[model samples]
Target chain A: MNAGRPTGTRLHWWWVVGAAVVLVAAIIAGVMIGAVRLSPSQVVGSMLDRLPFVDLDTGLTVRQEAIVWQIRMPRVILAVVVGSMLSAAGAAYQGVFRNPLADPYLLGAGAGAGLGATLAIAYGPNTGDWLVDPIPLAAFAGALIGVSFAYLLGYTVRSGRTSVTLILAGVAVAAFLTALQTFIQQRESETLREVYGWILGSLNTAGWAEVRLVAPYVVVGLGVVFAGRRLLDVLSVGDTDASTLGVRPGRIRLVIVIFATLGTAAVVAVTGLIGFVGIIVPHTVRLLTSASYRVIVPLSILLGGAFLVLADIIARTAVAPAEIPIGVVTAIFGAPFFAMILRTSKAVVS
Target chain B: MSTVRFEKVSVDYGAGPVVSDVSLGAIAGEWLAIVGPNGAGKSSLLRTAVAAVEFTGSVMVDGRLTTTLTDKERARLVAYVSQRPRYPQGMAVFDYVLLGRTPYMGTLASESTHDIALVWEALSALRLEAFASRDVATLSGGETQRVSLARVIAQRAAILVLDEATASLDVSAQHEVLEVIDALRSSHNITVVSAIHDLTAAAQFCNSVAIMDRGLLVNHGAPVDVLTESVLQEVFDPSIRVLEVNGDPVIVSLRSEEAYQ
Candidate 1:
């Protein structure tokens, strides 16, 4: 019954190229196949025209240009950042906890971010002011605070301060924060539309401002996670064994959690809680490829970007002028795809 | 040319000490088996060598105190096998064995060619060349034990600690596993400290024995000198006997009914 590509000798070189191609293809599809369609040459010439020292007029109207650059490009880039962070964070969580089912939000960061966004919307002095959008910043702070509280509670209640206790602490923290958020959301009935839209999650309102806000965190966080790939692999053997191998298990877990939560909070501030991408993309990579974090982590970054862009395509197009929440779209498309992978690809996942 | 010495060693899991005031030593190039009934703290005592568990008192490796050694430095001296080592799902046998090279690798760098070469050497030594690419989850229990040993071999540690590593294997597989370990032990002049429940196997395979009871070290010496019928009866409640087979003393416990007679 054990049938899979020997995960040890991962088909490393070829899949790196393969994921690149998939990303390129997914990016192309994301750019080209939107509602107000532009021809391939027009899109290419427009992109080329924007580059310095390469000014050529591929006749495009101001409106189409706005549609391409202002609307589509920012959404796609945000998708890339959010998707990459969630997937990589998910991989790190699973490795540190040594549990395959672990997800990025296992530490209550997402719920904390959700509460932060709600508070900014409900209680901030200028709810109507778009010039200084406090939601993203507040959400980032709340996420870190939330995880800190969970870590503290886990440390206090746990006799040994094990990984499982941390997960349980996250669950307890998430429930409390979500309840508090719901209470506030209900009281602030005036901004219900904004609150609902934010909670449901959407990239339709994405702009260069939102992308600019989260880009640096995404870049730095992913870099730290990449550097920690081998250590994460060692951690898969569990914390005690990892310490025996000379790396401090507690320190590594803290560093990874801190950096990953930073990136995840940044994205959640803008995108809300885009659920399934964090948990599913890494798992899909594992089932199709290898259990080694070396393979899974990098692939998660690539494929997560691709998967979200594809899901966004459906989210925007499925019912024209009535946008579906990006979070819901991820599950609708991802769940069945994951099931198919589980059935057809008999890789030893656990 | 190394010796592992434990002095006034005591391990407590907050409730009480599992291994209390146990002074033990294993000379270089020797196999020392720790034996006792369940809850005798044999595993806890063995775990002290690898620093896997927290313990009071001092453990010294080749005259260097354990507390003074860094984690990687201690790893280079000791390799440990659990009662049941986990084979991560879908991990190839080669990858699991390659984990042994973690101590030698820098944080950012992957395995070097030399690290890979040692993995191959260890695999071939254990006759696991063909299984290198196979999924570790697919291996039989005996093969899994051997794979763990191969990983330890790749580590190239001077001291080996096994906590009933072959407890789940069949009778023939147990003997085979012990023989392979002994062969590697003598060839490389490695020191071994194992906790085994099988008294006969411990007597037959180990150069010396240490008997523990209720977290205390009760006896320590050569197997023949320490495993006498009278000595064992004092520790074990049941009727026990020492039999002579090819001049080796083998310990066995009789049934309750036979004990009364």
Candidate 2:
């Protein structure tokens, strides 16, 4: 393991090119191979003619047009956003903890969002603002609370300020909060079903409003983490080294934890707790690319977004007329894919 | 200029005191070596002096109290190189050495060409020019020690603290490293405080030796005066024949009482 250069390295630029190609192929597959198999030529011609820059018609508008634009486009966009957010958050969390096992879920972001969304479902619909979209707002609030609680708990302890301690505390908090949510759900039948469904995670109901709500938080959170990439590098060395290297590990960790949790919370608040995109996607990308934050951060974002869009396509078309929980589909596919990656790839210190 | 003075310093690592009421001073360009047996608190004293470990009492460096100064300022004045640092796998040897310059770098500023050049110079001084591009993880024990030395050299700090820095290396590598350190002291006038395990190496290299036993300073004097048969017997529980070679002391440990006494 002690080598001058990292072992079995993959060139980062190559991965970017490959990811771009895969993304394009996935998009085409997503559009053309739905319940109704549209011809590839027609699909391409229609896409080109309908382009805002070049207005040429490939024929057929009404029903076909609505299906492509309103139905398919929004879902695709949501998938991309959720995917990118999870992947970026995963990468950030892993960097901060300096452990490969750390993902968005490890720090209570997922459970907290679930708890937040559950509370909102229990209380929000009665507030008389159908325009307000309680699920996203309440889930956002829950996510913020969960993340802040984890940070506060970790920060408060003097000797237990390690990333390991933070994760353990988060797990405890998640368990307690999940139990409380369940107890609250038991009190009402209608809300119990909502809670059950929310915990399982779904992206079907996500719309433009949900998308708009998460966009700003995601952008700001990503920006904050990106700015602190250097600090993350210092942190990879132990705390003592980080201090000697002119970085205040305590403050840097606090900021990173906040930004990462916020992004995870925002995405989970809107789309529930989608798994694997955060944990699996970043690892796959890292295996293909360099561990350099300058490359990994942006690549994970793009690749994650693309992965989610592709996954969403599978979710929608796999069982037409009725959709499976997006979480189930991601877990089902991600488990084997992740295992394969592990089997083929050299061990990364998790 | 680094003027390190510890006044009645005491270091306690939880259970009890490891170093108690120890007072010492090392001026700029002075090299002071602390030589002692195992569990003598030599490492603790050095760590406490650099403020890497907590200690009670006053430590003054360049006229400012160590406790009062920020970590960054303290790091600028003193650089500590621990024996056999556990480097991250795949970290380049050059990059590991360049970490010495971390205190000088800005939060966002990438390692500049000047920093890299200095790192290279440090590597070259240690005769590790060919290993610059190699990973630190792949290095042998001797090579790793030299890499750690290069980092401290690149640090270019006024005061250098090494905790048994050459213990892990072979005799030849030890001499090679000590020679480089000797050159640094003469040319740059950098003050060095090292905890050396080999008594002969200490006697040959260090101008002044501070011997410790059971967390207390036993003797502080020139190696010729401090290193004696009775002192060795009392401290080490073994009798050694002290020989005078060209007016310098050479310690020869007796295999048994009949062999020399």
Candidate 3:
């Protein structure tokens, strides 16, 4: 699925290493050449000086260090975390749901975050303290609440916690949240531009505080997901067959849904709703490399992180100071990429 | 001996009871085929053995209640091949068969060297080693079914269960798969319980046949005894015929379109 024809075989280790290099290069590029262009040698040398027993120097001042570490590093790291998380979550969701179209936000992450962010924009106090910011906190709470309700509804439905039921429940909850978000946007048209920016998504607000806020959830969620990767492969074989193989499909789904949504919701809380990384990256990895989740999940993480960070570089640089929403950048790239995959891969449905 | 037994097992999937109080057993190393018309609950009955469906009563493999066993323990005892095997898109055939080691792996663990070796052995056993590196989706129906069997063989489960394992294949492929299964059963001394749609194939390979009619097991005996005219006419259409070939009973595999004809 490496975003094209899927008539392929095993994912090579070299490709994974290549993806890692891409991520590292993207990070290096993203850190340098921003609004205030900084020297790469000085930045890299200063970072190497901090390493234990290894020393290096290329003459850096305190001001540049602040710009690199405080502003750029956190922002790039956030992009890596958010990007890798979304892609991994998306791949996990697709495997659990067995639908290539499934994504990290398939179960209420986007809509819930939208409604919360909208509410904060329209009526919340303009607190200077980013620590207690109502916007991200509200978004986080809203996302968790929305997914919980979806799970509950799907579980209680006549047939019970089938993937279809969970998906339908997600759709319903998302619809309701999106409707509420729209109403808020309409009633407070004065803040429509602010709301629109948040909806379109950007990493402009990324800082150490935002990173700290999302780190725990993302870490725990991704750990659970990575651990369950093999189970996901088993679950892809359908519930009955997976059960016959001694996999508890229902339990595994619940665990994955809870954790993957947690990670997606955490990132959405901070980054707003960036799209395409979730849907495009995983399938692309699957097609290009291997269908095995063992390969897909890990590769999706690296490539997804690299892809978004590079997209972020383009986003901030393309228009020169008038930054396009990072979501817009991803969509510009992801839409055509998605189409190519659809055209070339007959195995998407299989 | 490791065996499978269902003691008064009944399955009800909300609409109604699909299988009702089925009491049956398969001895170790024996192939017991469940034969019935569509809707006679063969699938549902098989589902209980794998714990794929909710059911009342007991399904015991190797004298232990399947419900009481851990997932790993149950997996070690029984392996199943579905009627419609999900050929996960773009998955290498070797990787697909490696999934059979799920029970042996830690939750977060990748397959070990031993696991890889077993997969190779399974692939060779099924005559599928050549296709190991190929995508599972590229295989023909017969080859895909063999891949499925190889996965189960790698599982090392003492009991093997299949549902219409060869229904999708041509005659040659059907025998090709059945022969491998027969070889597995005889060589490994594995217990096999399969719901077979092909009556002749069922009669040819199975040690005994259990005939189901509307969720009840009405007859259970050797193929020669159970494939008689009286049983065939009662369970299937009256036009259904059975004949002897080289001392082996073969169902005609068809019903006369018109009773007059």
DockQ of each: 0.57, 0.29, 0.50
Q: Of models 2 and 3, which has the larger TM-score?
A: 3
Clashing residue pairs in candidate 2 are A2-B137, A2-B138, A3-B135, A4-B134, A4-B135
iRMSD (1 decimal) for each model: 3.9, 5.2, 5.1
Per-residue CA lDDT of model 2 for A1-350, tens digit only, reads 22353222223577678777776666666667677666666667767876789876667567777666666656666777778878888888888887787888876777777777777888666746576777767777777777777777876876747777787778887787778777778876688877877777777776676778778878887787777665665676667656655567778877877887787888887778788788888888666554555566777887888888777777877898777778888889888987887788753543
User: What is candidate 2's TM-score against the reference?
Assistant: 0.84
Each model's TM-score?
0.96, 0.84, 0.95
Which stretches of candidate 1 lie above 4 Å from their native place?
A1-8, A48-59, B258-261
Chain A TM-score of each candidate structure, as shown: 0.92, 0.88, 0.92
Winner on DockQ between 1 and 2 is 1
> lDDT tens string, model 3, A1-350?
11231222345779878988988888888888787887767767766887899877657678888888898989999999999999999999998988888988888888988998899889997757555778888888888888898888889998766899999999999999999999989999999998999888899988998889889988988888878888988988888788877778999999998999999889998898999899889878776666778788888888888888988988889998799999999999788977797688755545
Q: Identify the runs in model 3 with alpha carbons over 4 angstroms from their true place.
A: A1-12, A129-131, A337-350, B253-261
For candidate 2, give the lDDT of residue A43.
65
Q: Which runs of model 2 end up more than 4 angstroms from their true locations?
A: A1-69, A122-131, A158-160, A182-193, A346-350, B13-16, B37-40, B67-70, B167-180, B183-189, B213-216, B227-261
A1-350: candidate 1 lDDT, tens digit per residue: 21342325654788999988887677767777777887878877887898999998878899988988988888887888888889999998888888778887778887888889889988887855667678877888888889998888987983877888988999999999989988998999898888888877888778998899889988888988888988987887777667766678878888988898888888888888888887899999988888888898999999888888898989988997778999999999899988888899988578
**What is the C-alpha lDDT profile of model 2 across B180-255, one tens digit per residue?**
7888887778888899888888889888888888888888888888888788778876757788888878877768
TM-score of 3: 0.95
Question: For model 1, what TM-score does chain A reach?
Answer: 0.92
